[model samples]
Target: MSAPPSPSSPRPRPRRPGRAHGPGHLIGAYGLLALTALLVLIFSLALPRTFPTLDTVDSILSNQSIPAVLALAAMVPIVTGAFDLSIGYGLGLTHVTVLQLVVHDGWPWPLACLAVIVGGAVVGVLNGVIVVFGRIDSFIATLGTGSMMYAVTGWITDGGRIVPGPQGLPAAFTDLYDSTFLGLPVPAFYVLALAVVLWTVLERLPLGRYLYVVGSNPRAADLVGIPTRRYTVYAFTTSGLIVGFAGVLLAAQQQIGNPSVGLDYLLPAFVGALLGSTAIKPGRPNAIGTVVAVAVLAVGLTGIGQLGADFWTVPLFYGGTLLLAVGLAGYAARRRMRTGAFAARGSPTVPPRSPSSSTQDGGTAGTTP
Candidate 1:
C-alpha cells in the first residue's frame, strides 16, 4: 500500500487569481476600459484636428453626462435582482411636470424640482409594491408602470412640447446643466457625484450589503434573516430617486419639454449598465464600472458621429454592444466559476448578514437571475 502523506507535507494549493486566469482575468477586468483609450487613440490619429480637440472632448462629456446619470439610476434596482424599465418613462413624466409647474403654474424652479424628485421616489415605491407584493415579474411590473407614466407625460404636456413663456426658465435653473466646474461642465460633475454616492452606498454600507444579498439570492438572503422584500423595495425607491434627479438635469439641459426624449435614453442607460457589468468588476454591476462603460460608449458614439456614420447606426451600435456585453458577462462568470478561490474575488468572506458582505462575496446563488 502507498504511504499516506504527512500533514506537514505540501498540499495542492488553490491557484492564485492572476495565475489561475492569467490574461483572461486581466482582459475581463480591463478590456472595456482599454478599449475606451484605444478608441480615443484611433480616432485622434484618424481625424487629428477634430477628434483630439478640447471642444470635442467637452461636448462629448457634456452631452453624455445625462446618459451616464441615467445609467447609474438604472443600476440601483439591478443590484437587488430587479429591473426598473420605468426609469425612462419616469424621467419623461418628471421633467414635463417640472416645466409645467415652472412655466404654466409659475412655480419656482426649486420647488418644482423638489416635487418631481419626491414624486419619483413615490413611483419607485409603487414599482416595489407591484413587484414584491403583487408578485409580478419585475420586468413586467416596471414596464407596466413605465407605460402608465409615459401616458401621464403626454397627458400633462397635452401631446405638445412644453415650452417656456417669454421669461424662460430661471437662468439659475438652466445653469444647473450649463454651468462649468473646474473647467468642465457641471453636469459632468453631477454624474461623478452621483457615481461616488452610489459607490459608497452600494460598496461601503450595510444597506448596500442587504440589497445585494436580496438581489443575488433572495431565497438565501431570506434564510439568512435578511429582509429581502424590504431591501428590494429600497432598491426600487433609490432608483426612482435617481431617475427623478436625472429628469431635473434633463429639464435644465433641454430647456424645453419633449415627451419623446425619455424613450431615447432608455436603451443607452441599459447598454451602459449591462456592458459595464463585463468590466472593472466583471459578472457584477458597479458604479465606477458603469461610469467607465458609459465613457467607452461615449467615446465610440462620438467617434462614429464624427466619422459621419448614418443615423441608424446609433441604435445598431447600442444593440450590438448590449449583445456583446451579455456574452462577455457569461464568459466572465464561467471563468470565475471557482469563486471560492480566496484571492479571485478580492474580498474577504463573511457571514451573509455581515456589514462588509459584498455582493461578489455572496457564498450563495445570488448572482444574476
Candidate 2:
C-alpha cells in the first residue's frame, strides 16, 4: 500500500511533462536537444570540411563562452519572475574596471580581478535594492543601472579602447581565457560549472524552492512566510556575481577594453535564457535548459557563419529567436501549471491557469521565465 500526496503539501513535485507517453511528449521534452543534434548532423553533411572539424568546435566553445555565462546570469533573476537588463552594461563596466586597474593603473592582475568581481556583487545588491525597495520595475531599474554602467565604462576608456602597452598583459592573466582543460576550452567549463552550481541550488535545495515560490506568486509566498524581497535580492546578487566573473573572463579574452562590446551580448543572452525555458524542464528557466539553449545557438550561429550568411543574418536570427522563445516560454509555463494542477489534485478536469498562480508548496517548477 502506498500513501497519497497530502493536500496539506501545497507543492507535490509535479512529474515532468515528458513522463507522458507519445511522440508529442518526447518531442516536447527534447525538441530543442533534438534540433541541436539535427542541426549538427545536417551541417556536418552539408559543410563537410569546415563544419565537422575540431577547430570549429573549439571556436564555438571559445567564442560563445562569455555569452553563455551572461545568459545564465540573466536566467537567475528570471527564476524569481524578474529581469536584470543591467548585465550587459555591468559586464562592460566590470571588465573595463579590470582593464583600468590592471593595465593603466598597474595593479596586480589577481587583485584587480578580485576587486572587479566583488564590485559586481555589490552592483547586484544595488539592483536588488532598487527593485525591491525603490519599487521600480526590474526591467526599468536594471536598464537605468545598465545605462549608468555604460557611461562609467566610457569614462574609464574615455570612449576608446583600453590597450596595454606592447609589453601586453601578464601571461598568467591571459591564460585565464586562453588555457585549455580536459581537452575543452576552459571557459566552457566555467559555463558548465556555473550551470551545475545553479542547478544544484534551484533543483535540489530548499532555498531554490523558496525563490520559485516568490517568482510564482509573491503574495502567496509572503502568506507562507517566505522573505520574497530578500530572496529576490539574493537572486539579483547572484546574477551580478556571475556577471562580474564573466567580465573578468571577457577582459582576459579581449585583452583590450572596448566600451561598446557589452551591448552586443544583451540580445543573445535574453534569447538563450527565454529560449532555454522551453527545454530540459519546460515551463521553467532551469540551468540545464539554459545551457542547452546556449549550445543550440552556438551551433546555429556557427552553421550560419560557415554557410556564408550575410552580416545581418546574425542579428536577424537573434531577434527572431528571442521573440519565439518568449512566446514559447509563456505558453509552456501556462500549460505546465494547468497540467501540474491536474496531476497534483488528481482532478479529472484541469483548472484554468492564471498568470499569477504559484507552483506546488514544495516543488520548484514555476515561472513565466
Candidate 3:
C-alpha cells in the first residue's frame, strides 16, 4: 500500500459546520424547549387535573402520530433539494383504496392491507420516475401529481367516506393504533422506531453524504462521479414510501376512509418539515429535528385546542410557522455562504496580487503596490 498522507500534503477538508451547532443555535433549542415546558406548565395550571394527566399525554401522542409520520415523509424530499407535495393527496388515495378493497370488494383484511401498501409504493415509484426521467421541477411535478391523486381519491370514494366494517375487520389490525407499549400508545412507539432508523441512516451512513452533496451542488456531485440522478430518484421514491406507510397508520387510527381528511394533514406536515430545518440540524432536514418540530406543533396545538381555540386557528399557526421556518433557513444558508466567503478571503495562502505585479516588463515583478 502507498504511504499515508504526509502532513505537508494537501488534506481533505474538515467536516462542514452543521447549521445547528453555530451561534444562535441555542436560541432555537432553548426557545423550543422553553415553549414546550411553558405550554405544559400553563395547560397544567389552567386545566388543572385534566391537562397534566396520563390520558392527556396519550391523547396527544395518538393524535399526533399520523401528522408526525407525514412530516417525516415530507423531510426526505427536502433533503434532496425537493419537496413531495403529493403526500397529502397520496394519504387520501391510500386510505380510500384500502377501504374500498376491504369493505366494498369483500377482500380479506390482510390481503387488502398488503394491496394498499403496494399501491402506495407504486405511487412513490411513479413519482420518482416522473420527476427524474421527465426532467420536471419537483414542485410543479408534485403539484400536478398531487392534483391527480386528489382526483383519484375523489373517484375512488365517490367523494364520500368509506366506513370500516364493525364486525368483519380483524381486531388485531384495528387495535394497531389503540394498543399500548410501555404505557404509551403504539403509534408513538412506531414514530420513535421509524425516526431512530431513519436518523441513524441519514446521519451516519455514506448515502447521507452523497445526498448532501447532490442537494448542495448537483453539478459538482456529477463531476465527481456521484450518481446524482440515482440518488435524487431514491430520495423521491423513499419519500413516497413513507407517506404511503403513513396512510396505513391513518386508516388504522381513523377506522374510516374519508377523502376530505387527507388535505387537512398537508399543511401541518409541510410545516413540521420546514420548521425542522430551523433546529437540530438547521439549514438541513434531519430526523430528530423533524420529530422535535412535530412535537412542538402537537404540544402547542393540543394546548390551544384544549383552551377552546377556534378550529381555523391551527391552520393559521401552521402557515405562520412555515413562513418563519423559511425565513430562518434562508438566513442560515446565507450565513453559511458568507462564512465560506470570508474564510477564503482570510486565508494566508490565497494572497492578493499587487497592481504592479501584472506588468509585461519584469521590473515590477513581485513588487508591493
Candidate 4:
C-alpha cells in the first residue's frame, strides 16, 4: 500500500511538557505550585506555634468543608458562564427546612435531608428555567430567587434558629460531620471524593466541552448543534444539588440551623470560585483549582484567627483576593488567545489552486478536487 504509506510522513505527535499537556497548561500548573508554597510560608510564619502542626492541619480541613462545598456549588454554574447567588440563601433555607422537619414536624432525619436536597434541585431548575425561558441574566435570576429563599427562611423560623432536640435527632447523624476515618476528618474525605468525581466530569467528559462551548459562545455552540440551553440547565441543576448537600453538611456540622450564619458564607464561597479561575487551569473553573483555592483561604483564615485578627478582616481579605484573581484571570485569558493566534499564523498552510484552463497547455492539476 504505497510503501506502507511512507513511514517518514507519520502523523504529527502532540507536544507534551513532562506529564502535562503543553507549555500553557504547565505554566498554569506551576503557578498553583508557587501559590501553594507562598501560602504555606505565610501561614507558617504568621501562626508559628500552631499552623504547621498536624492538629492545626486537621482543624483547617475540618472547618473548611462547608465553605469548600459551597464554593464548588458556585463554580458549577460558572462553568456555563452563569452565577448562582441562591447558593448561600439556599443553604440557609435548606438547613432550616431540614431542622424544622426533624424537630417541629417529627419527620425522619434521612427523609428530611432528602426532601431538602430535592428542594434545592427544584430551585436550581427554576433558576435555569427563568434564565433560559425569560431571558433574564443569570445573576439577576439567582439574585431574585435568593431573596425569595431568604424570605421563606424568615417565614419558616420567624428569624430564629432551629436546634434539634436530644431525642428528636440521632447522634449518628451529627457524627456525619464530627467523626473521623483513619485519623483524618470525614469531611475532608468527602470533599476529596466529591472533588475527584467533579474533576472527572468536568475535565474528562464531552459534557465539559459542551459547557466550555456554551460559556465561550453560546450562539456558536447552538449553531454547531450543541444543546446549549439543556447544558445550561444541567449546570444549574448540578449546582443546586451540590448546594443542598452542603447545607445538610452544615446542619450536621454545627448541630443547629440558624438563618443568620449562612449569609456570611457567600463572600468566601465566591472568593474561592473566582480565585480558582486563576490557577491550575487558568481562566477555567476547575475542581482541583477550586479545592486548592479553598484550602489556601482556609489556611490563611485559620492563621489569622489564631493570630487574633478581627472577623471583619476575613471578609476584607476575601474581597481583595477576588478582585486580584479577576484581574489575573482576565490577563491570562487574553494572553492565551493572543499566543494561540500568533502560533496559528506561524504554522504552514496549503497552497491555493489555479484555474483548470492551464490544462489546455499540457498542464495538469496536482491537487485533489
Candidate 5:
C-alpha cells in the first residue's frame, strides 16, 4: 500500500483561487456603487446648474427616505426567506388610522401615533401566525392581508381624503418629516439611524445570524436545533413594526391621508430591497445594501426628471431597473452556488482501505502476505 502523506509533504493546492477574489468578483463587489457614481457624474455634467445643487440633494434624500425605510422593512422578512406584500396596504391603513384618531377622534398626536404603531405590530403578529402556523405562503398570505388592509382603509375614509383641521397637524408631528438637522432633512437622518440599527442587529447580533441561517436553509437550520419558525415570526413582526414607523413618517410628511399613496411605494420598495441583495453583501438581503440601492434609484430618478423626460419615463425606468435587479440578484445567487460547489468538489478526500489491507499494514514485518 502507498505510504500515508508525509509530514513534510506539500499539500495539494486548489485549482482555482479564492472565490472572493475570482474573476468577475470585482464586478459583483462594486458594480452597483460604480453605476451610482457614474450616474451622478453624468447628471452633474448634463445639468451642471441643477443636478449638483444642495436643493437636488435635499430633494432626493427627503423623497427617498420613506421608500428607503419601506425597502428596509421589506428586507427583514426576506432574511427569514419570507415576503410581506402587505407593507404598502398596511402603510395606508396605518397613516389613515393615525389621522382618523388625531383629526376625527380628537386624540393627541402622540397617543394617535402610539396607537397606530401598536396596531401595526398587531397586524405583523397576525401575518406571522398566518405564515407560520397557518402554513400559508408568505406572498399569497400577505397579498390577502394587504387586500384586507386596503378594504379597511377605504372604509375608514369612505374613499375620501383625511385632512387635518384648519389649525393643521400638530407641529411636533409635522416636524418629524419636515424638520432638518445639520443641513439635511430629518427623514434622511431617520434613514441613516435605521440603517445603522439594522446593520448592527443583522451583522453583530446572534438573532441576525439565526434569521440568516433560517433563510438560507430552513431544513438545515431546523436540523441544527434552531427554532426556525420562531425566528421567521420575529422577522415578520419586525418588518411590520418598521412599516408602521414609515407610515407615521408618511403621515407627517403628507399631512393628509390618501389610501392610494401606499401602493405606489410598493414597487419602488421591492425594487430597492431586491436590488440591494446584489450589492454590499452580494447575494444576501442586507440593510446597508438596501439603503445604497435606494440611493441609486433616487439619484437615477432625480437625474432623469431634471433631463425633462416624459411623464411615462419614471415608470419605465423603475420597471426596467426592477427587472435588471432581479436578473442580477439571480446571477449573484447562481454564481455563489457555483463557487460553493466547486470548492466542495475540490476538497481533498481519503481513499478507503479494505480489511485485508488494514490487517496487512498492522501486521509485524515477518508476517505472511
Candidate 6:
C-alpha cells in the first residue's frame, strides 16, 4: 500500500468557514426588524387613511414610552442574569407616593418628583441587598417584595385615586409627558435618550462587559476576580432607578395616582425585554432591541385595534406574543451555547504521527548496526 501521507502535507480545505454566515444567521439578526417593517407595510396598505398617519405614530410613541422604559428597567437586571419582578409594584408605589406628597401634603411637584425618584433608588438597593446578601433567589425575592409594595400602594391610596387639586397638575409637570419635541412626544424623546444612554453603558463601557460576563457564567466571572455580587447589586439598583423615573412619567401622564395601573405594564414590559434578545444582538438582552421590540408590539396592537378588533383581542395578542417571545429567547440562548460548543469541538486537531517518519528512523538504526 502507498505510504500514508506525511503529517505536514496540506489537507483539503474546509467546506465551510469556521463561522457561519448563512441565511439562519441573517434571520437570527434581523428577523424581528423585518417583521416589524412588514407589519407596518401591511397596516399602511390596509388602512391607508389611518394607520400611516402622524396621529398613529404619535399615539404609539406616546403610549408605549412607559412600557419601553419599564422594559429597559427589566433588561438591566437580565443582563446580570437576574429578574426584577417588583418593577410594576414599585412603579405603582412610587407614583402613588409622588401623588400623596403633592396632592395630599402640598409638596411642590418638582420636589415630590425628586423624592419619588430617590425612594425608588432606595427600593432598588433593598432589592439588591435581599438578593445578594440575603442569598435569596432574584425572582422569588423580587416577587415577594413586589407583593409587599402593592400592599403599601393599597394602604397609601386606600383603594382610591389621588386626583390633583382643582389647580390641576402644574402645566410644566404635565408637559413632561404631553408636549412634543421635533414633532414627537416628549416621552418618546425620553425613551430615545434613555436607550442611547443604556446602549452606551452596556455596549461601550467596561462595566457593561463585566455584567455580561457575569450573566454568561457567574462561576467563570468569579474565577476571573470579578466582583459579581457587587455588580449584580448595581444592576438591580440601576433597574430600580430607571423604573422610578418611569413612575414619574406615569404620574405626569395620568395626572392621578391609580394604584392598579402598574401591574398592567408588567407583562408587556417582560414581553418586550424577552423579545429584544432575538434582535439587534441576538441571544442577549439589549437596549435598542428592547426599544424596537416595544415598537413592534405598539404597532401590532394599534393595527389590530384599527381593524375593529375587540378589546379582548388586544390582550389575546399580547399574551400570544409574550409566549412566542419567551420561547424564541430561550431557543436563541440554547442555540448560541450549542454553536459555541460546536466551534470548540471543530477547532483544528493535532496532526497524527507520520508512518514515513517512523520507517525512516527504523532504516537509519538498521544501517548503523
In order, the Cα lDDT scores of the candidates are 0.87, 0.90, 0.80, 0.83, 0.89, 0.89
Spell out the clash pairs found in candidate 1. 80-215, 216-366, 217-366
lDDT of 4 by residue, 1-369 (tens): 122233355445433222224676677756766766787888788777788899988898899999999999999999899999989999998988888898899888899899989988998899999988889999899999999999999999898888776664677778889999999999999889988988999889999878988987899998999998899999999989988898889888877779867798898898888788777877778888888889878877887888889989987888898898788777766665665665566544433334453353356755655
List, residue by residue over 1-369, the lDDT tens digit for candidate 6. Answer: 576556688865543323545688789878888989999999999999999999999999999999999999999999999999999998899888888998889888899898888888889999999999999999999999999999999999999999987888788888989999998898999999999999999999999999999999999999999999999989999999998899999999999999999999999999999999888877889999999999899999999999998899878988999899989988888887777677657756434434554474453222221
Q: Judging by TM-score, tell me the better candidate of 3 and 6.
A: 6
TM-score of 3: 0.85
Task: Report model 4's TM-score to 2 decimal places.
Answer: 0.88
Query: CA shift at 288, candidate 6, in angstroms?
Result: 0.9
Candidates 1 and 5 compared: the better one by TM-score is 5
Better of 1 and 6 by lDDT: 6
Q: After superposition, how far is residue 169 of candidate 1 from its true place, in Å?
A: 1.0
Stretches of candidate 2 off by over 4 Å are 1-23, 345-369
Give the least accurate 10-residue stretch of model 2, judged by summed lDDT: 352-361
The C-alpha RMSD in Å for every predicted model, in order, reads: 8.0, 8.5, 7.3, 4.9, 4.9, 6.1
Per-prediction TM-score to the true structure, in the order listed: 0.87, 0.88, 0.85, 0.88, 0.89, 0.88
**Per-residue lDDT tens digits of candidate 3, residues 184-258?**
999998899889988987889999888888888899999999998888888877787787778777778778889
Residues 1-369, candidate 5: write the lDDT tens digits: 675544575646554522555447778877788889999999999999999999999999999999999999999999888999999999999998889988899999998898888888889989989999999999999999999999999999999999987899889989999999999999999999999999999989999999999998999999999998899889988888998899999999989999888999998999999999998778889998899899899999999899999989988988999999999888887877777677668755344444655555683333333
Pairs of residues clashing in candidate 6: none
Decide which is better by lDDT, 4 or 6. 6
Candidate 2 lDDT, 4-39, residue by residue in tens: 445675553445432344675577679999999999
Report the lDDT tens digits of candidate 1 across residue range 37-100: 9999999999998999999989988999989999998888888878899999998988899999
